[model samples]
Target chain A: MTLRIYIPCDAAAVSVGADEVADAIRTEISKRKLDATIVRNGTRGMLWLEPLVEIEEAGKRIGFGPIGIEDVPSLFETAAHPKALGDIAEIPYFKSQQRVTFARCGITDPLSVHDYEKLGGLAGLKKAIALTSADIVKMVTDSGLRGRGGAGFPTGIKWNTVAGTTAAQKYIVCNADEGDSGTFADRMLMEGDPFLLIEGMAIAGLAVGATKGFIYIRSEYPHAFAQMNRAIEIAYTKKILGANVLGSGKTFDLETRLGAGAYICGEETSLLESLEGRRGQVRAKPPLPALQGLFGKPTVINNVLSFAAVPTILAEGSAYYQEFGIGRSRGTMPIQLAGNIKQGGLIERAFGFSLKEIIEVYGGGTYTGRPVRAVQVGGPLGAYWPTHLFDTPFGYEEFAAKGGMIGHGGIVVFDDSVDLARQARFAMEFCAIESCGKCTPCRIGSTRGMETIDKIIKGEDVANNIELVRDLSEVMRDGSLCALGGLTPMPVLSALDHFPEDFTPAHQAAAE
Target chain B: MSQLPRKPTQKTEAGAYDLELVREIAASMKGLDGPLIPILHALNDRFGYVDDTAIPVVANVLNLSRAEVHGVVSFYHDFRHEPAKRHVLKICRAEACQSMGAEKLFAEVAAALGDSAQVTLEPVYCLGNCALSPSAMIDGKLYGRVSKEKALAEVRK
Candidate 1:
């Protein structure tokens, strides 16, 4: 009997030497003439344990991680190696997760459509193939599915608009241009389970009248690009994609396009502009993307998670997925726990979990072993929540009410040594750099805000500069054309609100 | 104090570019939906930077104005105007990396690699590997947990 060994080829795992571990395993197997089937799967999102290796033993997979080339030979001898963590499902970090979008990740060979299908892969698309287009749209709409892409727009409504629109051609644009710092769930999804994204996009095509799709991925994600392209090719061969999708006489084919390091391109309009081979400048709204998008056609532009969630929504029926989450937010969110976190990884859970639980329970506190001072939930534009505000629930409205966001579900932890003044300054600096230069408040105001923050830090007219910053942030929030300018104040103001001492002369003097 | 240096010639040295190669690269990628950005990226990949002279060639091939081509080249941060040194080191300067002491690591790396012509250090907002913070990318390959020692080794190599 041949033993099945699972090793991750996901970029995050590879970064920590998974590739070398794979190579060592291959060489050892060949050297020993051992009969083993090595599967290059995706990371389980337990990043601290990556280059996580798993071996199938009597229908159960045993896990070992932080594995190196030297540990490979030892892994073959016994599963009792120092790095071994017994069975994978038994691991508390993974056991706790209610993985919906990331279900196939770290469990199957990414490129193998066979492996994908066996793990309940194409059931949603299969169900989608049998349903009427209106029924499909209604299913998603009924699922209470909102856009997972920070904005929290209703996914089903966006599709319904495109479905109703009369056009010769429409497109399903998957915004894989995940530019947020603490976010990599999209990358993990694409690399680990590319077929899921393919199926989701295909379902989206069936839901809407769109026959074409495009995944605008960032150039930085080389691994995701290769995996998704390969998966698309395999999907085409299997009749999962192409003119007659699943022999249903429906046409929906899409290809991946690489974005050239423009953070603004994450915006749907800017993404459309870049997709058309122009500067990634944000276009004016009132012509929402659902009406006039992607070469002036009705396009459904959704984030990777939003699209990936569709397959499960269609497969298990809307009621099952809708039942999990709290408030208006439904389904599970793949929260990327990153930065100073001791157990940094992806945690997919229902919406009602508070910030305190996510950081203290799942994260195992900061990596530096210091008391956690602050945490930045969402992305670059998200607010910095001090420890006292840790009780804020993870729901979109809940977070928004507390002046925070669950942007792309990226939570970055920070320790006691952090200076929030520097963080506030960085927010303005980031906005200034990434702003598409289309709006004044985002472009010019960010630079001005940075200057004001600098003045506050210098203790020169601190009170006046703080007032000036508040004024500038208000204008940027209210007056900007897009969220780039609008929501940047979420971080700046939150940092100011929480860590006011960081800006004071007394605090600076004490630190010095 | 009328210092008359009439017009500071902003002309970049251009003769190093292969005009035929530029045409070939543009011609190969002409079928793509949005060919200009792809062609520029291909050109940037081949030559360390997009040559100023190649802009006219691309504009001519794509049948667009030189300004149109140049606008795109300047707009994207990844599209460098000048040739990169032998190596380029991008340190993650985003909030995640900051939480993990990237600023201190970045300063140390900059100081260690001070004024070295062979290597260039630039700050990237994020590289999407926040799980392992204080990450750096040396010539496109990402490294996590980029301690001062690891960064120095990578630079020195």
Candidate 2:
């Protein structure tokens, strides 16, 4: 029998030379005339192990890697040895992760329905289809899955509200406008395992009593957009989407709308605006999207990761998923480890993992191999934790207690060489540039915030300007229309609070 | 005092600027109050950057001033006053990329192209490729961990 092997060809994997590794494996197999099958699976999120190849034989899947194209020939020869590429189960990186949402990510062919079925993909939908709408909502509620879009709202509560509302038309919208600076898990999931998202959305539609769903994806991810479009077409062709899916006598429809690169569109209301062919701007809450959204109909809007996590919760059962995390947070979060890091990649760990473990151990310190001075947990909107605060746990509540957020689970590690004041200014600049201008705080505050920071950096009445920045941050947080304005100050304020010396003019002048 | 050259008046015609298409797009955007960016993006995508010819159609349909439409079109980085070139090369200058020797990479890129970082070379902040470090945007396609050689080859290609 020919030995079967799989490697991920997803863009993230490809960017790290997964394609070259796959090609090399093919060549080596041919050169040796070895009877072997090679399959391309999505990344396991142990990105440090890219070009990660897995082999199957006698009911076991064996993984080996971080292998480059150059190592293929040697890998083939070594595979023939009795030792057979040291056991994948032994790799510390792989062994440590709690892979719930990404359980089948690196193990199965992304587009293969058969592979998906064998590995427990649509089983959730199949089971979900059998349950009543209320039952489905209850199951999700019991699973303890929160919105992964940084808000951490309970998925069940959102669904229950939308489901209870009686409206002529209801909408289910997936916020795929992932514009956060250090997040790509949404894009990766959309490209590598699109059907899971589709199924999750379908289940959401069923649970919410919404007949129409729209995926508002950002235009920057053209590849993911294309893949998602093709996948939707395939799904509709297979009766996985559209009316009466799986012959269950329920009608649900999904279409993708692309946003023209507005960072604000990542906000649900702004996303709704963009979907309706208008400028992306934030709307005031209370008449929340769950009540009146998307063409004045009740809408259930969830992030791509939140909805994508649905199928896993349904398939594996609520208790099984809930048991993974600690305290209020449950299930695994796909934490994106990016920026000046040696082993930068996606890491899906249960809630209790310390930030120190992720940065020092998994990240292997900075890319420059220098001492890590600071780390930005979450996206650009997240806080900058100094080295002393590395002991904070990765859970949502824990992060919040430490004046941080596990915002979209993106960690941007920075080394000693970085200037905290410059970073703080950049945060304000980013907000100013991307602000929708619908509200005063985000629109005007960001610009003023930037100016104040600039004054502090320039040493013009530094103490007063620092106070002004703090006051401005508070106003933005309390008075802003949406998160764009509210959370923009987290990074700026955190950087200032943690590293005050960086902002002093004397220190800057001395350094220069 | 010389009046500021009485900013030239624009001519309008029925069916010349596709009023139906504009209305259809606007109708799709009905409830989203003050939807300036989305409207600008849609118009730009449809008619290529809110030209004077399309201004009336957009304004009348979206219920905004031509100046308001113009202001919005010029505001966003994603929107361009003129049509984009065949290729757009955006270098990353975010904190993550900065930490990963992007400053050196930026210099090399500018030196190689014989231009300044601010003017000739189009530098953009993060494109969300932080995990790969030093990501760049070439013709809308994102490249990660970009070195001098890789950037040159991508730009040349």
Candidate 3:
């Protein structure tokens, strides 16, 4: 019998020398003449243990990780190597979270459609093939899966609108432009379980009346782009995608498009603009993408996670998925724990866990071994939460009520050494740089916001400057055309509201 | 955060580009829906950057205006106007990377690679490898928990 060895090809894992480790393992296997085959899979979301190698023994896969080249020889000698972990699934970090979207990651070959189907893949699309389009839309609408790409818009409602619209060529646009700093769920899914994205997109096309789909990924994610494209090619060959999907006479073909480092392109309208080969400026509302999107046709544009959630919603039934999460933010969220943290990785759970519990239990606090100072929930535009407000539950309304957001479900941890005032300044700076310039509050106001924050930092008219910032933030929040301009104030105001002492002259003096 | 990266001006040295190759690539991709963005990206990949020279070629193939082509090349941060050095090192400068001393590390990298066209250091907001904070990508391969020595060795080679 041939022994099977598993190593991750995940981008995060590769960042920490997984590729090198994989090479070393191959050399050792050949040199030792062992009966072994290597299976390069994705991360188990235990990023701290990356370069994680798993060896299957009697139907149990033993794990070892943070592996150096030297560790390879020992892995062959015995499963008792110093880095050896008993079954990876048994690890507290891996076992704790309820993985719905990322269920097949780190388990099967990403490019293999057969491996995907063997692991309960295509069940949703297969189920959808048998149902009425309205029933499929009704199933998703009943599942309560909101957009996981920062904006918590209802996914089912977006689909329903497109389903109702009449168009000759409607499109299902998969927003794989995962631009947020502290997120990688979409990347992981695309690279690890590419077929799931394919199935999800296919189901989406069948749900709506759309026959074509496009996945717009950021250019920075070269690996994911390549992997998704390959998976799509295999999907076409397997008859999972093409002119006839699953021999059901339904037509849903897929293509992957790359974005050239424009953060604003993550916005649906801007994405549509970029997809049309134009400057990625935000288009106005009242003509939402659902009604007039992508070459002026009805389109169902959704985030990678939003579409990924559909397969499971259809497979497990809406009631099963809906029962797990709290409030309206149903199903599971693949929460990314990034930055200044000891155990940084992905944690997917039903949307009700407190922020404090996640940080301590999953994150293991700051990497520098210092006390945690602040945690910026969501991306750059998200509010920076002080430790006191850490009890806020991980839900859309819960976070919004606390002046924060679960944007793309990214929570970046910061240590005691961090200064919140500088973070506030960067928020404005980021908005200024990435803003599409379609709105005043996001474009010009960001520069002004930066100047005001700089004045506050300099201890020159700190009181008045703070007042001025608050005024600017209100305008940006209410008056901007899109969320880019509208939400730029979240980080700025959160820093001011929570850590007022950080802006004081004495605090500046102490830091300097 | 202070200096907005410089954008490409309208001036062009037209004779420098491989016009035939640009036409071939543009013509090959123009059949796709919204072919302009794809054409610019292909040109960028083939030439390592897009510039005023290739813009006219792409615009002509897609039958769009020169301004339309240039607007796209300028709009995106990834579409470089000049040929990158032997290597390009992108340090993650977003909040996650910043919290993990990426700014200081970036400063160190910039200083080490000064005046050397052999390598160029650019700040990317995020590479989506946040689990490994303070990450850097040199020549399209990502390295986690990057230090000055690792970054310098990777890019210099």
TM-score of the second chain, each candidate in turn, equals: 0.88, 0.68, 0.87
* Candidate 2: stretches off by over 4 Å: A2-5, A19-38, A53-90, B1-76, B114-121
Model 1: what is its DockQ? 0.32
lDDT for each residue of candidate 2 in A1-512, tens digit (9 for 90 to 100): 98998888666667667877888888888888999988877776666566677777676767777777766666666656432445665567767887767666666677777777787878898888999999999989998999999999999999999999999889999999887767888987887788899999999988988988888878677667777777787788778887888888887888776666678888999888776655677788879999999988999999998998899888878888888888999988998888888888777888888889988788888878889999887788999999888887778899899899998988888888888898899899989988999899999999999999888888899989999999999999999999999999999989988999899988778756
Please tell me the TM-score of chain B in candidate 2 relative to the true structure's chain B.
0.68
What lDDT does candidate 3 reach at residue B39? Answer: 74
TM-score of each: 0.96, 0.87, 0.97
Report the lDDT tens digits of candidate 1 across residue range A1-512. Answer: 99899999888888888888999999988988989989999989999888899999899999988898988999878646898899998898899889989998999899988888899999999999999999999999988989998999989999999999999999999999999989999999999999999899999999888888889889888778778877887888898988899989999887888888989999889999998888999999979989999989999999999999999999999998899888899989999999999999999998888878888898999899999998898899999998888887789899889888888999999999988888999999999999999889999999999998988887889998999999999999999988899989999999889889999988766766
For model 1 chain A, the run of ten residues with the poorest summed lDDT: A75-84
Say which docking band candidate 2 falls in: incorrect
Runs off by more than 4 Å, candidate 3: B1-16
Give the clashing residue pairs of candidate 3, or none.
A150-A408
- Assess each model's interface with DockQ, reporting 2 decimals per model: 0.32, 0.21, 0.44
Better of 1 and 3 by TM-score: 3
After superposing candidate 1 on the true structure, give the runs of residues whose Cα lies further than 4 Å from its correct spot: B1-16
Identify the CAPRI category of the predicted complex in candidate 3: acceptable
